[model samples]
Target chain A: MQKLTFPRMGESWRTFKMLLEDLGNEVVVPPRPSKRTLDLGVRYSPEFACFPLKILTGTYLEAIEMGADTIVTSGGIGPCRAGEYAMLHHKILADLGHNIKMVVFEPPRFYPFNFIKNVYILNRARHSIRGIIALIKKAWRKLQALDNAEKLSHVIRPRELITGTTTRVYRKGLEWIDQAYTNEQIIDAETAALEALRNVPQNPEAEVLRVGIVGEIYVLLEPASNLEIEETLGNLGVEVERSMFLTGWTRDNTWTETTEGMTVKAAAEPYLPELVGGHGRDSIGNTILCAKRGFDGMIQLAPFTCIPEIVARTILPKVSRDYDIPVLTFFLDEQTGKAGMTTRLEAFVDLMRRKKHFRQGNGLLTG
Target chain B: MKAYLGIDVGSVSINIVVLNEAGEVITGLYLRTKGRPIEVIQEGLKQTAESIPPDVKIAGVGSTGSGRYLAGIMVGADVIKNEITAHAVAASMVIPDVQTVFEIGGQDSKIIIMRHGIVTDFAMNTVCAAGTGSFLDQQASRLNIPISQFGELALKSTSQVRIAGRCTVFAESDMIHKQQMGHQIPDIINGLCEALVRNYLNNVGKGKEILPPIAFQGGVAANVGIKAAFEKALGFPIIIPKYFNVMGAIGAAQIACEEVSRKGETSFKGFQITNLPYRTGSFECDGCSNVCEVVEIFEGEKVIGRWGSRCSKWDITGENK
Candidate 1:
């Protein structure tokens, strides 16, 4: 059997890796995509392709170089260009003369059945349905643990009295979770990490600006692609809450009957009225929810030339006007510079601070 | 006498202004940067020093613009700010009730919305140079007229000839076609102004409530043609300040004054910065796979300023500092 590999989008990689391993398949987890990976993708991709597709292509190229003969990646089924990514990537790799097998887990079409079949074929010899189900359950639990650790770090990092203490502990927590081999070990690591985080000194009364980040999932989870925006905001004393999480998204979209995605769709109805494609509806709904929850401001980070995001960008102004919460949208690509982004962020922070002061002086609620 | 100094080092021009405690501009200098930002800044400082009174003490110094960090390090600035904040401050000082600010500089343009002297919203042009000063400069040279006279020529037009203003390349090609169609030069120029103003309104001013009492500043405000076009399009009179071209410098100086009043001390390095032997260079740091290009500014062979690195390993001064 050929080795399988996938791009590292979030902590879901660990869960995916465990599931494939339990099925008795040799899986090669490619290293985290860096600038070198991006350059390789850019050199071979169509000039105007969305940034995420380029990163995925780069991941596959690297994995193939590391003896990964079969590539596994998520495929989109929608009006957006995401639906075309898998076929395009296949053509790009074949054109580059690297013949390989690919199994794209496209949702709502070849979902679950194809997934199960692929796993069964990979297992061949030790195919126990009960063990596979248990393995999947354990992976799900680990994903939840990983998500909780990340949420705690996001909450504690901004208000830490000693600069970088929360960040250090958060890194250790992630490392602990990543190294744990069993469900019990994962639970223990999270508890110890959370306890260490609690020990980090934080000013309870510090007035921290709360920012909600809503955008494409690839840019949201991958710090390298988005220029470590969450870290940068934390350093600037802003408590950032991400609008998307892998475990929640997977549960909502598959297997479970979850109303979270439906609720967001309803909230976005007045503005968007239709799910244009990708996360366009989610971006609008999340920004509205964040504002309703009293967040100071919202940031939308999308790849340059992205279609669905461009739709959201066009409609976000209406959201900003109605909610009275400033929304800053950044179109990121390889051409984006840190200096310009930093300057815009600083100015946006200044604007939010002054708005808060103005409301306070007028005897109104700062939120 | 105590004064505050503001240095604005932009891609197209460099400006320095000194303001007294009363917020009056004591002396100002504007020079073309022409790619040599460091040399131009030094010349601007030396020239500004010669114009100001010898007894005037530099109480505070602030730097702004695209090249602000480098300028701040060279001048020991008390406050380093972005162009939006600096421009908003400058506009508010000029017209206390300014609701909208239309700033069109050489390479970039921005629209800042304000309410009661505080900035409420702002947007800047990205990846497009259609409505900036450089676009107008190119059109002026193409039409074989001095940029200073372009505005006057537009005012003399009796009819309108539309030129595509969505992109620079399209605008130039459209201008040539209009010329071939026998449109009068003044009419074509006036149409160009109207097109650029339309582009700015459609791109930068989209979805913003631009109220009355608007102040138009930046180097591009020197052109009366664009100002008139804006006035006609928005159905409001555009107020051009006396120091419209040097407002960024003025705003930086105002911020420095505010900083000094709050802190009761100054970080101004003084006029001697002009004589300091400084050198700037950049090299790619191969620490990780990122390979970030880190720029270093040296003052007499000591690394005083470093930037452009994604990480702070070479910044010397910690990232938070």
Candidate 2:
């Protein structure tokens, strides 16, 4: 049997990658996603496909074309359409005449059998303790770097002129971390990149409006999914506070202590009560939290066929009413374009500015 | 004297309820949405306004449902709540000890679990159309039977027939196969009711700790066949409130009454809102990687509302204020 390995991006990705590598397989480390990678993903994927689908599909296809096989990915089994993506991708690959064995990591409640099967696969990997420790350390370094880079970007990008420079350096740093053999080397590369990026000049006239970004996790992270919404907001003179991040997501799943033992419910309870069958809980939580945190407004981004976000759409108006905050939900898919979205954002920002001015002038008279 | 108004706008139906200062429903209207929420709401409001006495003043308005926001804006709602909270409130008002709520509406279904008059847990099905009223309406039309009489006909079944109700496609095919196998119409109808009940139980009601005193509302509650099926399956009589079809509206109205009495004011735009020109359109925002499709709602030429934004960057009214 041929051995195959997976590249870990965050927490699970690191553990899984190590387990695979320890199994004595030729591991393929996918390049950290950059503008080029996302562009490739968008170009190759079907229009109207979810953002994550486009990016992951691009990664898998790119890896495959690079002579890699035995793809492993996580699986979900709820009302959300995400769980079915793996199977659909598998079929797509098979129909394209690619003979690859796609392994899916399932959630505990949905597929108990898959849990045992995953354990068996991990056990097959010869290096039990040593390999696991190495992977954990590598993953920690990567996560810390990514988190620091994202946080710094948020602070530095509040001004306009230096935004592009920071992003460029950040991407380069990620690439270096991915290729780094030693943890110390990875940390050093990340710090050096951050320092260089921070040296760029920022716009003095940028008006920072605290904006909240909410919606499906993949679309929120993958620039391709949201059509580079965060970047656009940054350029438009708005400070984007994204509600989803790799660190929070991992904490919600793997580390119960970090999440205060609330498990899935704890992470989701603030947004939505019980999984409304999709990212509905997240949407609800983000909306309420954004309002409570005194965010000027919130945006909900999701795919067209997303059931959970749709449910969130129905409930958001109520949230808006209760908090007296305005929430706009954006549905994305393959067919979304740039020009129209920009116009809308321009109009929305203009409206917010006008309202802010009015409220400031009139005190309590305006709507 | 204060009054409260509630509006429930669903995909298939629009329900309006008016309650007096005492929080008792005085007049109610239920109309089919017929795929036109804006139009139906307008007509329903017009009719409701006419039915009410001129002296009866609306002190507060509340809205609930998938279309709650739009309805809230149109009616100048003081409170907007989800169907779960609204239903629980209405059910508790009538059946104080109501432990379960089985609400199957036109396009969706929900199971509300209550303990001592408070909503403890709830589950809703917005994706699947298997157990919804729209499914029953489609089946009734396919069978060339009036929807109103379809439920009664289902109750007349003498023998049981099995019909797959997991999905609409599977259920329709199963029904055709059963009909071809010489099963009686009532038996097939009974089978469908059973299948729908079974599907709901397996999907929405799965692992739910259902207690007695279950109240079945929503449009599907009109179906005696489904009621019998539920009773047969659960071995307990599911109570259907008097305002079965408009419980959400009733609940909203009750909530409005409470809200206004506490606040001592009304924000209703009045029945004149019917004359307001409202238009909606979608546009993709290409500000960055998050090319969000923003939906803009305009009143005449002015953009009154904007939604479908991934970042609150678009809607100005929601920005800082």
Q: What stretches of model 2 exceed 4 Å from their correct place?
A: A1-55, A58-142, A145-367, B261-264, B316-321
**Span of ten consecutive residues with least summed lDDT in model 1 chain A:** A358-367
Q: Which stretches of candidate 1 lie over 4 Å from their true place?
A: A10-15, A108-110, A122-127, A160-166, A200-206, A257-259, A362-367, B316-321
- Provide DockQ values for all models, in the order shown: 0.42, 0.02
What is the iRMS for every candidate structure?
A: 4.1, 14.4
lDDT of 2: 0.72
Residues A205-311, candidate 2: write the lDDT tens digits.
76667778888877776564566787676666667887777767655554243442244345446446776765677677767767777877788888776778877
Model 1: per-residue Cα lDDT over B140-238, one tens digit each = 998789999998899999997888999999988999999999999999999999999999999989888999899999999999999999999999999
TM-score of predicted model 1? 0.94
Best by TM-score: 1
